[model samples]
Target: MSEHNEGDLFRQFVGDVKPLKQTVRGDKRPAAKDTPGLIERRRAAQELGNKEGNYLARQEHISPVKPWDLLSFKRDGVQHGVFRSLKQGKYVIDATIDLHGRTVQQARQEVFHFLRECVERDIRCATITHGKGQHRDPPALLKSCVNHWLQQMDEVLAFHSARPQQGGSGSTNVLLRKSQAQKDKNSEKFNRKTSRK
Candidate 1:
């Protein structure tokens, strides 16, 4: 065949040839021990995970903002001295978040996440501006929501509306729980000081 016909002739020759069947080489190795039991266990675990995900989805919405007494809320714990300190504006706030015009939902998430970050950084004090809401019927919706959400977190040790220059009715100053690491460090320092004396 001429060079031009050589390509078509090659294609025809190849097409006429029977194709080889592919054989999947099965493993000659021993069967995996407890294969059926393992598969069953994996299936059960996945089902349980899906069930738990659905259950958790239903239980979401920030785990419900528990009934909190805003009037008596500032005084709600064992740290009378600490609460007094917060009320008295003794703690130097290291971080501050301004929630001036944010919606209640925005404020709640910001306050929660902000407090967690403060705790992680070992920051003891923070201030949140939750708008006094002078125009609103009741007043200070963000303030009240911040108060509720703050109490819900395990990190918040104490919080009180700030002194006038610090936003007064419009903001709150917070104290975070001392992490175990800080507590241990403090105890070690105290023990050393006492031993020296």
Candidate 2:
């Protein structure tokens, strides 16, 4: 067949199909430029996040505890009665945080933030539910970390293993130190009573 006839046959087969426009494969629009304040704002945000996470230290050398072991701690000035009460789960738990599935780092950050918020809100009693890690190679790793972490916190007056119905050895009851406002209120009440005498 002649080349002209072949061209005619190709046009007939193609019909009215339009040719594609030659263009760049990707987006042609220029990248958006960040404002001067935007960069600074992002940096400040990142620094703030780091600062928040910095409240709790990621200790390298941690003492491991058994899965079934009971956790106990008390600050030097914490009364024996208060510690005992905490152990017995007599104080009402104002807040509770469960760290069952969280990583060590995640748990550390969460614990720090949660306790800080609790103290700010004048919460006296809080419970931390760190599951006894019987499945892990080093059993109760998070529990041991929680035990160590609680001791290092000044806000924690005392803590003990929770009662059986409250998660048994898998959870801990924490006694937080009274906020300054609460202490001041107590002092004011005492003074008022004494003055009335």
Candidate 3:
């Protein structure tokens, strides 16, 4: 309230306030043209072919199969083997077939046709839902048939009972080879040109 007291308060406020400085000092920085340490590490990896020698050595331990080793015909001399289940997830189809209405021979034909078409169309994986043997009076006909049919098909790369959510033991997930058309289309797309900016 008094002029002396107000002057003293103003002096205290001025003494507490600090002035700002805006200059920065540092070591000379590298330009954009300079390669980082990561680049040198990558260059060294490229020179070594990123462990290709180790991969080749492992491959050498395994026996190689030749073109002549493969059967000449699609169905000729093809061995039948059961593929219990599949591990990978991305390539899978969930499909169901009604064997109840059809006869044994008819059901077999339908399954064969479906599998053939899947292979021709390049369907990598599919689920064949032949319901559980719960309702069958005798042994489960469709289940047994599907098991045998899958083994006979040459195009079936691998197959296994689907997971519980996908029908479990009642359903099978089949993996088929890509058709020639699919391979050609993929190669063509891969060989596509990019425009220069």
Each prediction's whole-model lDDT (CA): 0.67, 0.85, 0.56
Candidate 2 structure lDDT: 0.85
> Quick one: RMSD of model 2?
15.1
Span of 10 residues, lowest total lDDT, candidate 1: 54-63
* Residue 164 alpha-carbon offset, candidate 2, angstroms: 0.9
Candidates' RMSD to native: 19.0, 15.1, 26.4
Give the per-residue lDDT of model 2 (tens digit) for 86-154. Answer: 898899999999887677876776777678779989999999999899999778989989998998888
Clashes by residue pair, model 2: none
Give the number of the best model, judged by TM-score: 2
Which regions in candidate 1 have their CA more than 4 angstroms from the true location? Answer: 1-77, 137-139, 191-197
Rank order (by lDDT, best first): 2, 1, 3
10 residues in a row with least lDDT, candidate 2:
40-49
Which has the greatest lDDT?
Answer: 2
lDDT of 1 by residue, 1-197 (tens): 69879988898879778888999887675644657975575456446545543221111233322222222244356468877788888989899998765566445545655676688788998888776666664554555666657766778777777888887767778888877788899999999999999
lDDT of 3 by residue, 53-165 (tens): 31212212323222112111123332332232253334446444545444455555556656666768677677777655555543455666666566566677666666767
